[model samples]
Target: MLQYLTVPVTAFAQNCSIVWCDQTMDAAIIDPGGDLDRLLVEVKRLHLNLQAIWLTHAHIDHAGGTAELAERLQLPIIGPHPGDQFWIDGLAQQSQMFGFPHADPFTPTRWLQDGDSVQIGQSTLAVRHCPGHTPGHVVFHSAEAQRAFVGDVLFAGGIGRTDFPQGNHQQLLDSIKERLWPMGDATVFIPGHGPESTFGHERRFNPYVGTP
Candidate 1:
């Protein structure tokens, strides 16, 4: 079985999830944005053996601390696809502009694509390349548990902002309606920020993508 916890980090309160296997205790840290100390504390407290650092996108608030944490732990970094390299390359600038902690860019040890599978202990998560909010954005879904960790691609009662350089308003909607909806209405999604919601709830009420 897979077990997880949402650890909010940074001033943005990005939800950095620590997902692990119940049996082996092997774990992955998903989107460790900024609060390195908090994340480390959680890892130690949980007695988890860090296997990999997973990213959903390269936005500063969602991935600002990835490089540092991964380097310090000597863990492999994975996912977020490869298209968000530009955003990854600008981490230092983002940190300065946003008054974030020192953030440096690092390459993903493995660049995931749509249909990729990520294994944490005995559980596996499917990768969906749901871009638009960011070109390389992806959502990690555990089909067994009907749960997803969707970065900025989605949220409760709202959608990701498309004002950024590579953001596309239309594409974001498509990702939610097309890529995410098929996961099943009961699929609960954990967004980059804020509370969690199911696809069914979002489809019926989310002002941006729900029916009129």
Candidate 2:
């Protein structure tokens, strides 16, 4: 079975997920934005065989701790789309600007693209390049689990902000309605911040992108 736990990290309260394959006990930390101590505790408590670190995007709140964690564990880092390289390059600046702990910039072992797939032990996740919150944002979906980690793309009753340099309102909406909605109304998603929500609930109530 596949299971996951969401840990809210950083002052921004980003939801960092620790996903694992129950049968193999192999795990991957998704979006280790911060709170390294707490995250490590969970890993130890669960007796998970920590594998790689997966990212949704390079925003400081979602990726501030990637380099440090990956280096300390000698684990590889994967994801966010390659287009978000500029954000990765600005980690330090972003941290300082946001009053977060200093963040180091590092390259991902593999840059994800739409239609890409990643693994956590025996579990596989389908990756979709859903850029809008950032130019290279991506969503990870575990088909067997019917779950997705959507980094700042869609909130419970709202959508990603499009005021950033590379943001586009239309692109964000399109990604949700076209790419995400098709995932099925039963699909549950974990956002970078806020409470989790199913596609069906958001499709009906989200004013920004909901169907009338």
Give candidate 1's TM-score. 0.98
Q: Tell me the lDDT of model 2 at 204.
A: 92
Task: Give per-model TM-scores.
Answer: 0.98, 0.98
Error of 2 at 68 (Å): 0.4
Candidate 2 residue lDDT tens string, 39-149: 999999999999999999999989999999998999999998998999999999999999999999998999999999999888999999998889899999987899999
TM-score of candidate 2 to 2 decimals: 0.98
lDDT per model vs. reference: 0.93, 0.93
lDDT of 1 by residue, 65-117 (tens): 89988888899999789989999999999899999987999989999999999
Candidate 2 local Cα displacement, residue 62, angstroms: 0.5
Clashes of each: 0, 0
